[model samples]
Target chain A: MLFLRDFGPTEVGGFGISSANDLLLVEDIELVHQACSAVHVTFHDESVADYFDRQVDAGHTPAQCGRIWLHTHPGNCPLPSSTDEDTFARVFGKTDWALMFILARDGATYARIRANTGPGVQQELSVVVDYRAPFAASSESDWEKEYLANVHDAALNTKDTTVKDRDKSRSDRFDEWDESDFCDPLLQTQLRGY
Target chain B: MKVLVINNDGGGFADYMDVEPNTTVATLFGQVTKSSRAEDYLIRVNRQPCAADQILQDGDRISFTPTKIEGAAS
Candidate 1:
C-alpha cells in the first residue's frame, strides 16, 4: 500500500487491522474506497461502515479494526497537517485509543498514539517495518486492483505546495470536514440504508 | 454497585468503579465525559448500544467511544 502513493498525484489511506491480543501489531492494511486530492483524502462513509461489518463478521472486534488509521502523503513532509490534526482530534478523541500513521513520498514518516481512558495521553511513536514476522505472499495484481478500485484522484488545480496554501485550503476547500455524516458511525449505518 | 467502566476517550482505560444504585447511563456518562455531549459518543452497555436512561447494574460493562473520526489534509 505504501508503494501506491508513488503511482498517483493524491494521498491514499487505509486502516491498519490488528488482532485483539496484539493491538499494535498491524496484521493487515485494508484499503477502502475514497476520494483523494494532492493534499486530501476522505473515506466513503458507507465503505467504512461496511469495513467494520466485515471485520466483525471475521471475528475481529470494532476496536481492532478501527483503532489504527494509516495514510500516505504525496509530499516530503510526514508531519501532521493542520487538517490531519483536526481530524485526529475530532474523530479519534473519544476512542479508548487510536493511532495515526503517516508516510510521505520522500520516505519520512510520522506516528502518534492517543489513549483516552483516564487523563488523556498522547505520544509519538517510531515507525519500523518488521520483516522478521512471517507474512503472507502478496499479489501485485490484487494490490493494483485494490488501488484502482479505491483511489479516485480529483485533480488539484493549485500549484502551491507550501504550508500557507495548505492551511488556507483547510477553511476554503474543506467544508465537508464540518459535517459529521462522513465520520459518524451511526450516520454511516443510516447512509448504508440499514 | 461495582461496574466496569471502559472509557475510550482520552487515555483510554478500563477499571471497575462503585456507583450508586439506580445510577443511569446518562448519569455515569455525565460524570465520565464531563462537558462532552453524549450525542457525540457511542455509549454501550455490555457491548451493545444503550439508552441514556438505562440503569446501571452491578458488573455491567460500560464504554464511551466517539462515533465519528475524520482524516484530512490541509
Candidate 2:
C-alpha cells in the first residue's frame, strides 16, 4: 500500500509531501522485491549517477521511472526547508518523475511526488506514510531468484573507491590542522525538511 | 563539553551549548523544551530514533523536529 500527506500551503512552488513505499513498484512488482532483498544501499557518486542513467536507458520516460530519494534527519520534524528546496531543485530538476522522502529520528517523515503537467511547468503531489507495515515475503522461481541474487551481490561488491580516497585525504589534513582551529558553530536555527 | 542542538521546526540550523558529561537525552530535552510543550516535538540522537531516557554521549548529534508539517503548493 502507498501513503501520502497533503501540505495545505506552506510549500513553495507547490504543496510539499513525502512517501515511504518502494519506488521499484512503479516498474514491476517482482523487480521491487528483488531490489529490496538483493540490492544494498550504497553512497557513491558514480553508482548513483549510473543508477539514474540505467533507468533512462531502460526505456522509462523521464516521467515514468519515478525515482525515490531518502535521507535521515536528527529530529522529529518532517517539514522541508529552503535548503531542501534548493537541493531538490538541483537533484530532480531534470526528472519529472522523481519523489523525495526524508526520514527523521522522531518517526516523522515527509515526501513529495513530482510529475510533468505541461511544458515549463510541473506539479508536485505530497504523500505521507500513516504507518509503516512489514514488507511482504516474496516467492520467486529458482532461476529468477538466482538472477536477483547475482545482481545484488555484484552491486554490493562495487567498490566505493572515491569515498575511501577522500577519507584518506581528510584524515591526513586533520593530522596537520591545529586542534584549536576547529570550533563548533552555535546552532540557532530549527531543523528543516527537504 | 559543547554539543549541538538542532530544532527542525524553527529552522535547519545547529547551535552549540556547553553540556555536562553523562547527560541523559531526557535531561537535554528538559532544557530545550522548557519553553514549549514536550508533546509538540520529536527528538533523535545521532540521526537514529532515541527515547527520552537514553543517555547521550560526547559528539552525539541531537535533532529536535516536529511530528509533521503540511503546506500547499505555492
Candidate 3:
C-alpha cells in the first residue's frame, strides 16, 4: 500500500511483478519529472527507454524488468475507459507482456494484464487480499488503520479525507519515502461490482 | 567544430561528428540521417527544444526524441 504526499494530480510510470502463484508485487515506479501543465503529463519515450537500459545495465534481464504501467485517476472509478485500453494497446500491445494499474482518488485500484503475443492478450484482474502478517509500524502508515475503519461501502461526496489527510501528513513522512506509491490495499474493499 | 547526435530510432547511438562552422541543426540532421526524417522527432538542443533552423553551438547536447509515446488519463 502506498500514499501520496499531496493529492495533486500526477501521472507516474511503473511496472508490476507477477508469478504463477497469483502473487503480485508492484515496484519500480518512475514519476514524470518533466515540467508540464497541471492537466497534462509530458514525457519522452527515451526516458522509459533509458530506464530499460539502466535496468539492463544493473544486470536485470529484459524478462525480469517490468513492462506494465501505472497511473492515478482523479475520480474513484476503477474501470478502464476505452481511451485507457487504446493507449495501452498502442504503446504496449506489441511488447512481450504488459499491465496497467489505475489508482483512483478514493484509493480504489483497477488492474489489467496483457500477455506476450503478437498483438497481446487482455484480462482484468481482481485486486485481492488474503491478509499478510502485521507490518512494522514504520513500514506502514496510520492511514491503513483509518482505511480499514471506513472500508465498508466507502463513498465520496466531493470532500474526501484520504487525499486531504495525506497532503497534511506529507511533511511528516520520511523524505526518502515515495509519496506517489499511494494505493492502499483496503481500497479493494470499496470495489463496486468488480 | 564537432556536434553530438543521438538518434532515438533503432540503431541509435551517442556519437560525435565534425562539421563546418555555422551549420544549422536542420543541415546537420540531413547530413547524419541522410533524410529529412527529423520531422518525425522532437529535436532539442542542449536539452532545450530548438527550431531546425537554429544554428548549432559547439559541444551542445542535441537529442532526437521520438514523439510516439502512448498513454492516457483515467
lDDT scores in order: 0.73, 0.41, 0.52
Residue range B1-74, candidate 2, lDDT tens digits? 77766542211235667789888887987776442455444566665668877877777777654432211111
Model 3: per-residue lDDT, tens digit, A55-109? 4456444344445566655566756666667756655554456677877667788
What are the models' TM-scores?
0.62, 0.31, 0.46
DockQ top scorer: 1
Off by over 4 Å in 2: A1-43, A53-66, A119-135, A138-194, B1-74
Error of 2 at B44 (Å): 40
Q: Pick the candidate with the highest TM-score.
A: 1
Candidate 1 stretches greater than 4 Å from native: A155-194, B1-70
For residue A151, what is the lDDT in candidate 2? 22
Model 1: residue A2 alpha-carbon error in angstroms: 1.6
**Residue A133: error of model 2 in Å?**
11
Residues B29-53, candidate 3, lDDT per residue (tens digit)? 7765544656555577766668989
Q: Least accurate stretch of 10 residues (summed lDDT) in model 3 chain A?
A: A150-159
TM-score, structure 2 vs. true: 0.31
Candidate closest to the true structure, highest lDDT: 1
Estimate, for each residue in A41-95, the C-alpha lDDT of model 2 and write its tens digit. 2233322323323443454332333245444333456556555555455445434
Regions more than 4 Å wrong, model 3? A4-7, A16-24, A32-39, A116-120, A128-194, B1-67
